[model samples]
Target: MESKGILTKLYSFLYIRGFKVWTSYRTQVALTILSWVLPVFTYYFVGTSLGNSLVERIGVKDYTSFFVIGLAFQGYVSSIITTVSGRIRNEQLYGTIEYYVLSRSGVTSFLFYSAIWGFAVNTINAFIIMSVGLGLGIKYDINWLSSIIISVLLILSTLGLSFLSAAFTMVIKQGNPISLFFSTFTTLLGGVVFPVTAMPIPLTYLSYALPLTWALQGLRGSFLDGEGIVQEGGIILVLLVFNVILIPIGVLAYKYAFRKAREKGTLSEY
Candidate 1:
């Protein structure tokens, strides 16, 4: 009974913390929604420009639907993964690092809770944007279950990569370069503008190793190709395997970095 109570309190705290963070900045939330709206318009124009050309290249019956789905999935992947690594820098600047370390709580659990909040906001954002796309007659067959699965795998990959970034931030006491490097590398290599297969062979090989490549492919394939998520079961399984392999390694690396920071007496420095 005592254990149950503790678990209940933890879950409640998680939800409350997420909500508090989300609601604390009403202006930012509004701006985020507004900013997302602009992209729908941009994509509509671009898809219109592509005209019949996109059909020959993208292989989708409806270029509008494909473009919208791609944009939505990209938003999902970017928002989900970027939050964790980005948190490290923000927390450091705001003097929240020591608070996180000295709270008599594990960092991993707290990170997971914080991600749930980010995920919630982004999911709502995606829905709103996609609804507008639907209004523009951009409709495609999608499997919610497969999307959830892809989301789970993407989150795991994001957590691992974020932990890696957090470790770098903690050790170096800097964030800009590492953050920019990862964001840029993934954005270009992970098919944000177009398909990975369109890249040269050498770059295509590198794309295979990128976690976003598979996650985005899985999401886009489902909606644009009229394929079910389960149809891409092999890739999904590979993502799950990658996550299982990386989590322990990430935790261990973070633990080592944390210990090093404490020993160097630089744990509190931003």
Candidate 2:
């Protein structure tokens, strides 16, 4: 099938990138260990201080465990966004993006492969952190079915956001600001470190509108309550709806920007 061929290409791209990242074995392992344990120390102390008072308010039985799962998932989702948006600039500077874009490969194929590479790398990081948490006795819901479904939805939503940022890069010729905006917004409004429901009404509304809000909620649901997936089905549904609408818009915007860039002959300019 044509779809299968595309996926094969995507998978090969991811495999190559992952192999390269893994070649830095010592650094990768050390950083992965730090990622897992350092956060536990920070959140465990904070959560213990809040104790049952905050745990109950946040609708989770164990605040520390809840925080750890949410943080791990947030790390993965945020890393995907960060890498996809920033990779274009890196490749452009390195003289690879122009080659890829102008090659026989379709732009769609190139973008998909780049995103697959990012997703693969970040997924490894997420797994290392989560496995360490489990070794430390952080009980996970382990609903693979729900986790898979939510993961697909999260990737779709995030890929749409990635496209928007790529379009910004294609049009404006830089993506650092777009990356900064999403990173800051995710930390503030994504409910990774704290519950968004605790925020005031206005901020709560704003948080709900952000894509990462839905992502964190779905991830927390998948890993923490297990019931959160079914109970917060509305959020998941909304995210699905958002992907359906935004992905097409993002694609059109990206194509338009790409055409403009080609016309201006600015694709190679840093």
Best by lDDT: 2
lDDT of 2 at 52: 86
Q: RMSDs, each prediction?
A: 2.9, 2.7
lDDT of 2: 0.71
What lDDT tens digits, residue by residue, belong to model 2 across residues 138-244?
87776666677777787777777777778777667663565666656676677777788878889989988876777667777677667545776787788789789
Off by over 4 Å in 2: 1-8, 54-60, 228-232
Worst 10 residues of 2 by lDDT: 15-24
Model 1 CA deviation exceeding 4 Å by range: 1-16, 58-61, 176-178, 224-226
Cα lDDT tens digits for candidate 1, 1-270: 877865764565446655566668999878888887887788678767877765557654565665565566556446644666666667778877788777655666556555565577677877887798789986657777787788778777766766666677778875445455555676667765566777898998998886777877787776656566568898798888879876777778778888998898877677
Number of the predicted model whose TM-score against the real structure is largest: 2
Superposition error at 190 for model 1 (Å): 1.6
Q: Candidate 2's error at 206, in angstroms?
A: 0.8
